[model samples]
Target: MSALAPAVPRRTPLDSFAGTWHLTRFMLRRDRVRLTVWTVSLLALYAYFVTALSALYPAAEDRQGRAALMEQPASIFLGGPNYGLDDYTIGAMFANEMTLWMIGLLGVMNMFEVVRNTRAEEESGRAEMVRSGAVGRHAAVAASLLTVVFANVVFALLGSALLITAGGLAVADTFALSTAIAVTGLVFAAVALVTSQLTTHGRGATGLGLAVLGFAVLVRGIGDLQAEPGEHGTWLSWLSPIAWAQQMRAYVDLRWWPLALSVVAILVLLALGAFLASKRDFDGALLTGGSGRAEAPSMLSNPLAMSWRQQRIALFWWFLGTFVMFGATGTYLGEGVEDMVDDIAGSNPEAAKMFGDDPLTGFLAIMILYAALAAAGYAIATTLRAKNEEADGRLDITLAKPVSRGRWFAAHLAVVAFGAFVLTMISGALALWAGALVNGEVELATFLKGGAAFLPAVAVFMALTAALYAWVPKITPVVWALFAFTAITGMFGPLFDLPDAVAGISPIWWVGRYPQEPIEPSHMIGLSVVAAVLLVAAFVGFRRRDITS
Candidate 1:
């Protein structure tokens, strides 16, 4: 026994990616609409920006502006040290400015969820019925990966085309950037594939995928920031598929080999994931069951308490995230850095004109947006807890008690509404303390001001989520759709020259864009009123409606 080694499984040639194409057509049909939209919307977002940027900033001047900004440490940490900003266009600016933040984040979430939820769900028991008939195990996962890969490639081509049309880049540069971004996604998609095989639960799989995402971001951030200004973050960028795409620098340097690295990473990850997937038994969880406790814990007193008990881990993590993201660590640079960035922005005559004498407001505006968005995130997730409970059949028994439906919905709402407030405060407090600590301001008033100002916009999300949970349960996805819409609109809408009407839909537009200190009380009150109306409608509908599940 002391000398025994673990057993290894034998694999046959048949196990190596056979019969995957059989389900390709079915997968394409099922995901065609979704992929089309996902690819189109992302492309449109970049195209719109590229067009607007082409008009707003001439290529040569844009490059000069980027070069001036690279000298600032704050700028480097936040937006990546500029890629030797020469021959830059609006499209290049859009890519350089956002490559690390928005594009990277959206890419990771979209690809990871597609792999874990669509393909891994099949691997786990959800696909068994379909597999029992005409489907093969390899076919489903292969089809899904194909769909995801195709979607990414489409996005790449669309982005490249838009950049070429708007920015008038050399054809080679446009394709290089687009291909690099797509390759980056492929690498992460492979990472998700490997993660799904190792984890039995979907949540566990998602966690692994996110872990990989976090590593990519961290590696990219460190590489980009620590590198010298105008140096392209070189070898460090090679460590991350994202950094690889970013270093392609599109219209700037247009490096190619980094992308080859991304492709290699993807192939290796896919090979490893396939080998592991072949070894595991279907529907087999990673960890086996544990014996039940001899008796119930004292914490199982009431439904409210039980719900809290079950959700404590989530709450803790949310709180920690709120704390960690207070202004974001990278954005909080030393005074020398902040001063340097301000000088750079000041050096650009256009930015100087845009700032209108006070540029710090730009930073504050971003902070408010980030905090409000985080609060909105908390509100939506908390409200959706009721829907989840109902779906799980817990609500059926809970409603069977002396409890009324309204009371049940109200209890959950109360938890969410209060939790929303708590989350907001936590976010504000974190930002306030972080700012004060770094800058020696020592102002709770600053924190409270930021928290109070964000309320109206954030409150809207809580109300809408509650309304969605109560009345139109069929459209539950709206909670997230609206949440994401708000966030994306606020961030990209301004950059891309979207209609003021559409940008106005973001509560951010109405909240005085805080810490800039406009303090438009009337606008804040108006936003709150809108939120109140939605909440009232939800309450009324829930009071009258019957439970679906």
Candidate 2:
């Protein structure tokens, strides 16, 4: 008689998705406010940019002239693959101005969304508690991915609906363009989930994911530059998720293969992330470095120095990235931009606005703001580190030492300001070096001087954020909102036709257009004074407030 073979029970998809519904609901409830803000902000910005650009180039002839300018190296360096420019419509114009960057914005949104729900929960010990119940190992990950994917889908539908109202655009084209964007978001969200499984800390996961996003965008830009004249596709573009959407040529040919590639990539990344998550223990990382020295070094005695020590790794990475970005922008935007601008400027005077009246001057002006924006991000992240530590209970331990509340708070703010200065200097130097190399007639000193003109604005953001953290610790996340408000006002204020005084509220606006325009010494002095006042307020408020748990 043959022994009866034991049958292994098969698990359905529901088994893997166990507890995902409740988790998804919880995540949606938790993120509803953030989602609303992101959606509203993006929609508003899109409407403004689309409306402004459409008004600027309303006629087909104007659109064609604008499209010709886009073929220039300056345009290629900034915007990827000017599709449908031959018979360009208002919709195509909107896509040309907004698509690549919108993809980047959505990528960032998806990354933070995934990291917050997955690694952040795990790092804070909430994942363990949730998983101890009926939650499957992959439930949280599933819920997070679901929430972000749903958000992406909703945003895409809403954006496409807005695009339809632009007139002269085919409905199919708008749908395709929005689909491409949604797919790009999905791929990066998957990248974040994979990164979350690899790092024990949420910040590490966010950093790694952002690094990948930045590199992908760089590759896409290079590929766009290298694409042969009259060619629509490049092999280099195929390697980047950012370029896949552009490759779809949504408003042009509506190619489907590249989008299929994105979908496949998303599936593979999700599966790999789930596998990694299943193999690791909760709160454990697949990759880790050695622990710090048991005994504190003599140099660690100072609170400011300790803040630097703690933030050094993140600052180093950010500094390196800023250096690369500025250097590349300077090299690409230095010489050839003038010839290209001149060629198109005769046909469309509006080209001057895009390039800021003069090619080299405009490039430098834009690069200055770009560098300041990068520094602002560093400042905000560093400023919020103190609040994050306090939430983790590490602030109490440090305060239990010989440190006073005011001194401890002041040290963090000082470290952020100093770090922002160092990062700004690095970006400025690298930009000057590259610009000098490309524009052989330009002096390095002049370039450096022009780049340094924007640093005071960066400092103002740091001080303002520090003040908010000190007085309203619970609303520290609002710093990002503040940064967004500043960026939109400064960058798009002219396009949006805001009142001069309203635009002047942004510190970057006060910096003046450098190299093209002289530095406003009064503006610089005023910004410094503003920073000082904010710091004094922060010190006072921090001293009086109770430490947040």
The global C-alpha lDDT for each of the candidates, from Candidate 1 onward, is 0.65, 0.79
Candidate 1 residue-wise lDDT, 210-318, digit = tens: 6677667666666776776447675775577677677666666667776777778878987897787778777654443566798878656455666666566556656
lDDT of 2 by residue, 211-307 (tens): 8888887788888888887776488877898888877776667777878889999999988998887888879989877897998898788898888
> Which residue pairs in model 2 clash with each other?
none
Q: Kindly report which residue stretches of model 2 are placed more than 4 angstroms away from their true locations once superposed.
A: 1-13, 72-74, 85-89, 224-226, 331-335, 342-363, 428-436, 475-482, 494-500
Candidate with the greatest TM-score versus the true structure:
2
Worst 10 residues of 1 by lDDT: 328-337
Off by over 4 Å in 1: 1-19, 59-63, 71-75, 78-81, 86-92, 109-124, 228-237, 287-357, 385-429, 432-444, 476-505, 522-526
Residue pairs in collision within model 1: 20-139
